[model samples]
Target chain A: MIECNNLTFSYRKATPILKEFNLTLENGGIYGLLGKNGAGKSTLLYLMCGLLTPAAGEVLVNGVNVRRRLPSTLRDIFLVPEEFDLPSITLEDYCRINAPFYPDFSMEALKRNLETFEMPEKIHLGYLSMGQKKKAYMCFALACNTPILIMDEPTNGLDITSKVQFRRFLAAQMNENRIILISTHQVHDVELLLDHIVIVDNRQLLLNRKTSEITSRLRFFNTLGAPDTDDPRLLYSARGVGGFANIARREDPLDEETDLNLESLYELCCRNPKLVENIFNPDNTSEHEQLG
Target chain B: MNNLDNFDKFSFSRFMMLAKREIISSKNIFLMELAVVAGLIIIAEFFISWSALPSLNDVKEYPSCYYSDSTCVSIIFVLGIWGFAFLANIAASLVCLKLSNKKGRITTFMTVGTQGEKYLLNFLIYDVFFVLYFFTVWLLVDLVRVIYVDMVYPFEGKWVLFYAIDQWNWMVALGTIALFLFSQAFYTLVSAFSPKLAFLKAFGLSYAVGFLLIPYSFFCSVVLIDKSFSGESNVIVIMASSVMIIYAIAMQLLAYYRYKETDII
Candidate 1:
């Protein structure tokens, strides 16, 4: 379990990015963290992993404060940052140096992941392209087999084929013992893999719901060429090359189930926050999913 | 947060792993720095030793700076020892800078090991390992200089490894080392506090410390210039060494605190 209790953080000479933010993420789920640019998505991820300390409250991983960075804690968590430097060394040498620290690290799993990514087992890190490096690193991060894995923009540098490979590789890596938090702008790349969605904006958690809950509560449509493209019921809509992608509350039992459109869902939450909030928490109560 | 306090407990195995990781990851950087420092020290030693020759001395109007009270004690050699300390200062600063500099690097470092292990690794690399490397390089150079000078240059008195106790300049050497350690520690703290431009900042602020070095330099000048002034004034040596060592310890503690509290940007 990961818990952020009344977390407040701000950079020097800047307004608070997250103030009194409280969130609890349970294990065994792949959480897709969504937010606008500069909405503190990366900051929140850093704080969760103890890379940045919070000004108030604390982040607890498995009941221990992450800031302590105990070996027991360190070995169980691995972060793949949006940007990282890999020393100019062979992949084998890199693993030899770093793998011993992580007790659960599995060479077999690494080899498997490498195979899945279609990367050579003995590629030199310095010689690989940016996308290949990302693949190699992602393979290594998964190989560590840490219980809590946090990746910022993991799919940013991936090509189309690599992105598909990434989703497959990540899905295979997931287990009940692991919790993966991915903060990314590439929603389509992760939609099929993520089970939970967390959206934050300007010091607020605008939305936190499981895919099942989101699909159960709302519906999505491709209505660009349809006659009712501007339907009155659309909570949000965006014109596309084909037509409009639409999101609307699922009001009737007979309403056909449609896949959750993350982009349209984000628009609905951002454009009419009050109505969305009413739909999710009609009683105007502070209670919701384990979130703040 | 129940076991957070227990996380501070030291682990010997973890510390060893951290050592292994740091050495392997930074081997290139370590070797490059060693090469640069070695070159500078070698050239400086070569020139100083060659000029101290009696054959080269005949052409001089005044005694060479290498001669102190008619003995071939090089001021440049003394300055060379001080130079190592300044190198140590930069070395220490660079190590601290790693803990705070790049966001990605800082994230890895901050999350890698326990604070105690990481702090000790930083201290051992710059303060212990690099110092040993520096001294070993200097001694080998000095050994070569001694061998070359003894074989070719005719001298009335043979030069010894400990610089001969007859000329008690060893005290000056020891005293200066302590002063340099203080400088190293101060720069380590400065870098820990400001990693963005630590080398430049340390260079900028180093001049402000000359006032503190005036008294020590005065003692060194007196002892080296006046051969009559030996270790008889051991009180000044003891006082200066104690002051500098204490300052070094204090600075190290401050640097450690800053490192412990560092948040990766």
Candidate 2:
């Protein structure tokens, strides 16, 4: 379990990027962290991994203060950043030098991941292209088998085929005892793999819910032209392609089962945050009738 | 079952692993540096032999024994080795200490081991390992020079290896040790603080500190210590050694603190 208790952090004396931000993550499931460009998604990941010191409060991983960076805590956590440079050494040599640090590192898993990603068995990491390097690094990271794994923009440089392969590889790697938190703007790449969705905007968590709960509470559907529903169940709607409106409505007894569209939901939440909160939390129903 | 709770304060195995990783990453640069140093030693020896041998014949008034004593040649060889070794130490420190400056490398390093282990790894590579390598190169170069000179000149007296070490003064030995510590600590301090231009900053700081301390120490020894200690030269050595020791300790502490608190950004 990783918990951030009232974490506050910033660069130098500038305004705090994260202010009194509180979050708790448990083991199991893949979490999709969604946010705008400067919404502190990367900062949150850094804080969780103990890479940056928080100005206030603490981040505890499995009851260990990450700030101390004890070996016991460090050995169980791995982070793959968006932009990284590997040394000019063969992949085998790189693994030989680094794999011993993690006691649970698995060579079999490494081979399997490499094969899945279509990367060569023996090649200098520096000689590979950026996309290949990212794949290789992701493979290594998964092979480490740490309890907590954090990846920032893991699919940014992947080709179309490699992106599908990455999704399959990641899905196959997920376990009930492991916690994988991926922060990225490409929601579609990870939509099917995410068990939970977390959206942040302007230093606050806009929405945090399980995918099942999100799909159960709201119904998403398509309509011709604009949504002209006179029923008081509409929450948010946005114009879609071919003169159709992508609509999200409160799930009623007569409503049919509809799959949640993460991209459209993300856009609606960004535009109508208060409605999202009211829809998820039934206690705040005073202004719940408002529609967009 | 709870492996997380089994946290060792200091793990020698982990430290060794980190050291091995550092050596592997830097092996290529190490080999290139060795080659460059060897080339420089050969060129320097060539110039020394060419310049001094011709001068010896030009001044015929001096006795032949003075030219063939081997003491002058040995001193020059030792001084040359010390100069090159010092340069190598500074260069190695600059390169090795900045390994964690880059964003990706820092993240990887922090994840692999404890900060204490990382700090010790830097010390091992930059100070201990480089010093050993420098001496090894120095010994090999001196051996080759001695053999080449013996074959060419057939000197009357025996040429001893490390002739100065045979009649070593305790004061000089202590001073040398203190100087070595001071130089290593100063380089580490500059490297920890100025990772981007560590070599340039360290070089400038070394000269600035040397100029200030050397003049002050000379003035104090001549004016005050000479009068108080009744012409005892060891007093100056004692004072200089004490200052260097304190400076070394202070700089080392500062460097360690800076390294511990350094943020990747």
Candidate 3:
């Protein structure tokens, strides 16, 4: 379990990036962290991983403060940043150095991930291109089998086929005991893999919900032409080349979950923050105020 | 495990793994250091000792080794260069740890292993490995020079050959050890504070930081030339050694503290 209580952080004397932020994530789910360019998503991720020191409060992973960075905690937690460097050594050498740190690390898993990513097992890390390097790194990260894995922009440089391979490889690594959090702006690439969605901006959490809970409460779909004026449940709409993408409230509990369109969902949350919060939290029934 | 009071953050097995990582990761750096050390020695031996080459004209040729005219056994100036070369190599090699001032590289290193383990591993790599590698290269290069010098000058005492271990003077060794420790600490201090353009910054900062070594130059003049040279009282030598070693250790501790405070921005 990962828990953040009253977490506050800032760079220099600028306005606090994250202030009095509180969040909790349980084991056994892939969490997609969504936010705008300067929305503090990466800062939150860094705080959780103990890479950045928080000004106040603490991030606890499995009941231990991450700030301490104990080996027991470090061994069980692996972070793959958006851009990273691999030592100038062969893949075999890389594994030899890094694998021993994580007791659960499996060579077979590495080989399987490598194959899934369509990469050769025997390789020089320094020689691979950026996309190939990300693949190789992601492959190794999954192989570590850490209880908690955090990746920032994992698919940013990947090609279409490699992105598909990455999703497959990541899904294969999912287990009940592990928690995965991926921070990215490229929502479409990881939209299918996410079990939960978290959106943050201006030090506020606009939405955080399980996919099931979100789908059960809200319906997302695209309609031809502009949205229907007669529909009372339509919450948000975006004009696209094909048609209008829309998100609507699902009043009936039995309503089938519609496929989530991440772009539209993101637009809705950004434009109608109060409404998004009100929909998720029933106690806050104050009429939704659309932010201009 | 939550209490962390008895938690063994430093595992011998884990440190060994980190050490292995350091060796493999910095092989290129070590090679570069080797090249530098070898090159300096060649310059010290051949280029500086160009008295062998008859001057083409009456005009005097400028000397590269201004300080004591560096030879294989000449002290101070050559040792300073070696220290600088070693510092440059280590700083350049640890580009993964914010040495290159890159966010991704630093985050990669900061996320792995325990803090203590990482510090210890870096300590070994920065200090111990440098000493061993430098000494090995020094010995081999000196041996080659000794052979070449012997061939050119067949007379018994024409040239001062490389001194064997048994012939080493305790006073000179003490001074050398102190200088080496100071070098290690200086590198750590400069590296911890200044990561980008570190080598140039370190050399520039060396002058302001030279109170630690200015006295040693005087000590070197008295004892460096003659291995058997001794003094009436060892107070000056002992004092300089004590000051240098204490400063070295203090700088090391400060560097470690800076390391602990590292935040991967």
Candidate 4:
């Protein structure tokens, strides 16, 4: 489990990346961290990994402050960065050198993953293609078997076949002991697998809710005729092929079930931040039920 | 594998892994350079020994000892030592620059460990390794030349190895220390500004510092031009190198503090 309280970070004195950010993540589910470019998703990931200490807030992982960076504290977190340097050695040599770092590092698991991807064993990692390198890194991250895994844009450069392979790998590897956080602009790629959604934007956490609750309480629909304009419960709207419509409260007489598009959900949540804020607020328990 | 292990615990181990990975991967290129230096030392020893011998028949005033009438051996030795320092510094600086920019510019600080610690450790280890390789190769070449000269016509007063060590060891030691110190300071300042500009800036800054130091060295030489100034000048150089080491440590600490406070990633 990861808990962040009032986290604030700034690159410069005046330009803050995260502001009073608070989040709670439970174990055993994939979380889709959604944001536009420069929305601080990667910053939050770094904080969790103790790569960047929070300026004011505290990030606790399994009850220990991450900034303390104690050996015990680091064993549980792994971050596969969007950009990383692959060591110049062969894959085998790289594994040998790193295996000692993680006490639980599994050579068997790492080799299995490589076999799954059909990566050559003896070749220097520096010579591998970009996708192959990413595969090697991903395999290493998982082979470390940390409880908290953070991936920033893991799917950005993958081909179609690699994407499927990646998804299958994650699905097979995930367990109740693990908490996987994936931050990507490719929401559709992970929508079917994510159990929770966390949206960050405008220096705040706009929403954090279970995917099931989002699908249950709100119904996403398209409209052709007069759209419902005066409904206070309507969260966000965008122009469709016919007219403007949105994710609105499921009213029996007027609302109907349509497929929930995560891309649309991300767009709507970002467009009407205040409405989404109000809906996900813990204080608005009664309002949360109104959607149900 | 217990899932609850702390991730930061892995930083040092990971850092070593990364460093070793880089070293092994580049070993071929590094070895090639090392071979070139080794070959140069042997060739230099042969030529300098030929001119140093008292045998008038073997004396040469051309490439072997252009300053054969003066202190040709010492001058050649000093120049060789300076070349060694430059090579070591460049190698050390380039590695740190590469590591600093490992993840794109903004993301470098996001690597698993303390940036300053990793940077210093990497530079120190590589510099030490290179210096050892340099001295060992030079020692062997000098030893061979001394044995050859002793076989042909023995010198009256000097043991070649001891003379070489007495004259060259201090410079090599000081030069290693200087290279390590300057590499850290230069790379730290460059990396602090921007990764894209780090290597270029470091190169320019180090060169400028070297250029500035030339006049400084000349000034010191002029002050100590007396025949009895050898011991005093050597001590001063050692002290200056010590200061450089401390400066490197200070700069490394500053870079760490900067990283601890900044939120570039």
DockQ of each: 0.43, 0.56, 0.43, 0.28
| Residue B23 of model 1, lDDT score | 81
Strongest candidate by TM-score: 2
DockQ of 4: 0.28
The docking category that best describes candidate 3 is acceptable
Model 3 C-alpha RMSD to native:
5.0
Query: What RMSD does model 4 have?
Result: 5.9
Please identify model 2 stretches exceeding 4 Å from their true place: A243-245, A284-292, B1-8, B54-71, B77-85, B88-105, B155-160, B209-231
Model 2: per-residue Cα lDDT over A1-292, one tens digit each = 9998878888897778887777888889799999999888988888888878898989999988887778888888898989887777898998999898888999999999999988778879878999999999999999999999999999999999999999999999999889999999998899989988988875668787888888888887878667766767776667767755465665575777677788888887888787788778868645322110
| TM-score of decoy 2 | 0.89
Window of ten residues with lowest summed lDDT in model 4 chain A: A283-292
- Model 4 lDDT tens row, A1-292: 9998778787656577876677889999899999888878888888887767677888999888887655566556777888777757777877776666566788888877777777766677888888888999899888888888899999988888888888878887788989999999998678887889988876656668888777766777766765667987676677867776677765464455556668778887768766665555647633321100
As for TM-score, the candidate ahead, 1 or 3, is 1
- Residue by residue across A1-292, what tens digits does model 1's lDDT show? 9999988888986878878888889999999999889989988888887778888889999998888767677777898888888878899989998998777899999999999999989988989998899999999999999999999999998999999999999999999989999998889999889999898764578887788888888988886464364666667778878898877778885888788788878777777666777787889645432222
Of the candidates numbered 1 and 3, which has the greater lDDT value?
1
Task: Give candidate 4 misplaced runs (Cα > 4 Å).
Answer: A11-15, A52-55, A63-74, A118-124, A220-260, A277-292, B1-19, B25-29, B32-36, B39-70, B99-117, B147-160, B166-227, B230-252, B255-265
Q: Relative to the true interface, what fraction of contacts does candidate 3 keep?
A: 0.53
lDDT digits (tens) for residues B135-239 of candidate 3: 666566555544654444332212223333434567666776787677667766777776666555666677577754465454555456444345754666678
Please give the ranking of all candidate structures by TM-score, highest first, separated by commas.
2, 1, 3, 4
